[model samples]
Target: MAKDDTGRLHVTVKTGGKRKLSSKLWLERQLNDPYVAKAKREGYRSRAAYKLKEMDDKYKLLKPGMAVIDLGAAPGGWSQIAARKVGSAEGKGKVVAIDLLEMPEIPGVAFAQLDFLAEDALHRLREMLGGGADMVMSDMAPNTTGHRTTDQLRILGLVEDAAAFACEVLKPGGSFLAKVFQSGADAALLAQLKRDFTTVRHVKPAASRQDSSERYLLATGFRRASAVL
Candidate 1:
């Protein structure tokens, strides 16, 4: 089970299978949740994998031999999808994932359980990549308070950091994908991305719950900024 933005444990099961009201409700939802059934049939860790897949499909960002970095990657859901799409390490694709929480090892992918906010974390990620990355993905969300503004700011900080790091390390044609709450990313952030990328858009996949404020920022075509020596 995973916690939602409000620290509520979310479980996927057939709500119609039990007599209790809550159980029946939950089970019915699970039974009807296309993503849940798809995940189970496809052997994925969580239904969230489909979100990335949908995004990538629309943007055509993932490929068979690209280097990728996954921030806040846990339970290996997105990592698994990345690994499969990027091909094996020997074949030119590699994925390096990091989070403050420990995650089980996934074959053909590398992981580091460390806080991204910690000192030298970005440097460590660069070292892991060995070279620049073709894609940087983040599903990071800060610990939420009951206050909406507070939560939005915290999450915005994460996306800002991710975007900065990506600009520093992404290749000229690379892409960045990040999760953000709807209406959370400010104009400043969008302007910054527009300066560095050829294309920038916000996307909300159908798999995401309609009631949730979550959305994603999809940026493509990294532009090499001129440097002064």
Candidate 2:
């Protein structure tokens, strides 16, 4: 394989091979993915870093020394980026990241291994934070069922849970960012975010595959229910 100017591999599918067409296509795309190349160069865990990087660049959410919570932070990509942007957990800035899979420790991030929707997860997260967070980001997506409607509902559930958790833990003027399939962020979730936030918008970062329906719902300015309602 040869690399292009962007560092992405120049790969092509062969006519005949033991690999199926799907497998060949997947391999070709992975080899050609710009985010994958950029991730390797940047030492980030996953290409997902570009998603957050793009989002942060657009929203100006991350700041040094801010307290942050990262839900579904697996492989530590977002956490790695957050650590550099938000400082270390033991430092003036704190980042608490939780995921079902264990992520290697990042210098400025505190990792918790558990299910975000588990019985004690929220309690433990709060204990770890010691107070409300300045920003809450969740890239959580449910394992797809292949059935479009089912998959959409499942992902939407994760987004809703993440949003509710953010509402509970985010300080006023805080921000919430979560991943959702384009069709999954229903009216209720959008309304809820709008009710609690000054700005609620859906964004599809360039890092996401063009064929994918996934996007991020970015909500800023948390207006606590007690204050607004």
The total number of steric clashes, by the backbone 3 Å criterion, in model 2 comes to 1
- Candidate 2 local lDDT, 5-97, one digit each (tens): 787569886757589887888888877787888899989999999899888888788998888999989888898888888767558788999
**How much lDDT does each candidate structure score?**
0.83, 0.86
Candidate 1 lDDT, tens digit per residue, 76-115? 7899889989985556688999988889888778898887
Candidate 2 colliding pairs:
88-108
Give TM-scores for every candidate, taking all chains together and pairing residue i with residue i.
0.82, 0.89
Poorest 10 consecutive residues by lDDT, candidate 2: 220-229
**What is the C-alpha local distance difference test score of candidate 1?**
0.83
Error of 1 at 124 (Å): 2.2
